[model samples]
Target: MSTQTSRLSPEKVWLGITPTLWWNDDFINIDIGIPFEQCISEMALAGYVGCSVGHKYPTDRKTLKAALDLRGLRVSEPWVSTYFTIAAMRKQTIQKVRQQLAFLQEMEGGSEDPRKADLVVAEFGHAVNPLPVALFPNCPNLTDGQWDQLLDGLHDIGRIAKEEGRRLCYHPHLGTGVMAAEAIDRLMENTETSLVHLLLDTGHLAAAGVDPLAVTKRYASRIKHIHLKDIRADVVARIHADGLSFESAIEAGIFTVPGDGSITTFPQILTELAEVGFAGWLVIEAEQAPAKANPLQYAKMARAYLRETLGW
Candidate 1:
């Protein structure tokens, strides 16, 4: 009997990181005011080929393209906060999707590469991540009606994504409606596979008390993008014990780059992804205070660790 083998190749799976290393989207006080040029240049300096959009990224396509092309980096995906559960915000959410797709397409500059950028989306209708409230035992649960709204809105955006040659990858985020494993199950079971796919975030899953490897196994086919993050177990324990808010947890140094934290299932996760023939971006998205963690330093650390782990 003959069998085909699948592995993660440097050529196929690109390594990238979000600028969250330099700045925090949820808590701007964590930012160090790193200029856009330095932020992206350091990404390339760290041996990354791509990055997601950040708050500091210019909104102009030409300007953004010029800066990134200079560093040999490209945009991987951009996070979109979709208010699908809110009836009044639905139109605005779809508009945001369309705008982001247009921006992403223009960023490619009509490249012939078949790979399209992903839309990292999550429901933010009642998210507490931006608030000072506790994350656990505080995030609101979606009602049956809200679930229907969210799923229906996801399908709508998914179709839009397909039409635009992009993929809608739903990100199950902490302090959101779909943070829990059960909520993720509902999302996977209810959404149309063709329209909606998963953006697997390791840190978020781990922080929510869900096994990231189990999530990878169960939703292997549906997962189209990845956020390779690690978490500080000590900080997580404090959060649970003190009912710390999501923003507070982040400020308290709950998240870190892989190989720098307590999560030990990454090797198995990578092996499972390889076995499943997953070929895409593995983005290091450790949300930390830039001043304390040192963005470029941690970026280089993550790059070194990944090189060691993957033998690239």
Candidate 2:
């Protein structure tokens, strides 16, 4: 037998873990509770190649770098989990975008920690559906004008990221303005490759009634970041029946570790990404019940599955 290994680029297969794993009652949880250094150490100890800092984690350069150095982990990406809005209120949207960019700049300047690196990803839009009722009651089905506004905001954000020597990725999440497959397509169509990049989240794509692998293949060229979130179909069904919120569903166990879910097409997804020569950080965003499951343990298992099953 030939001993040739999968020849994907090393950069393409950077495994990352989100600090959301450490969100617990003890950690002061939301974003700031978990000590920055601990976050880096935990991620590194869990076998992740990098760490993606969420909104709650410390964004200061000094703190981030110190943690990275302590844990010997790299900053895979910094996620602006919030900031984009698909509302009709142009002024509010603009304000949010400006504030987001400002935050990014602040973090960059404050990145005194070797591990607190660049803001590599900027997600735009949310998953709030039932248009005209949910978050954007005034604007159901993101109008052309609203889309233009979002695009403008992304353009500005992208400019800042580029100048700061970072990459800007747009995440199309479930229950947000760009929830459906067509909506993602539309947004991608409207966006220029140079202005923004795609953060392919498999779980959100599946939750939104789209084939995650299909969308991944379709937008393979635009994707730069990846969130490997797995979901439980039964819990998802219950959430649908009860009209429960996404956050609630997460609380109720609508998602779990990669190997513990109903998502069975992992090999295919890995194959497709490999075929397309798509290389980027593969982040394990296992949003399971914190009370029942330990995030660090689950994350470690997910990393094992990715390596064994996906050969990543």
Best by lDDT: 1
| Native-referenced Cα lDDT, model 2 | 0.64
Candidate 2 residue runs with Cα over 4 Å from true position: 1-5, 9-11, 24-38, 81-140, 310-312
TM-score of each: 0.96, 0.79
Predicted candidate 2: what Cα RMSD to the true structure? 4.9
> How well does candidate 2 score on lDDT at residue 99?
60
Best by TM-score: 1
Model 2 lDDT tens row, 72-173: 676666545434454554455445545655654554455554333334433344435323232222223666766776777777777766665556787776
How many angstroms is residue 305 displaced in model 1 relative to the true structure, after the best TM-score fit?
1.3
Residues 116-194 of candidate 1: C-alpha lDDT, one tens digit per residue? 5788999999888888887887887999999999999999999999998888999999999999999999999998999
TM-score of 2: 0.79
Clashing residue pairs, candidate 1?
none
* Number of clashing pairs per prediction, in order: 0, 21
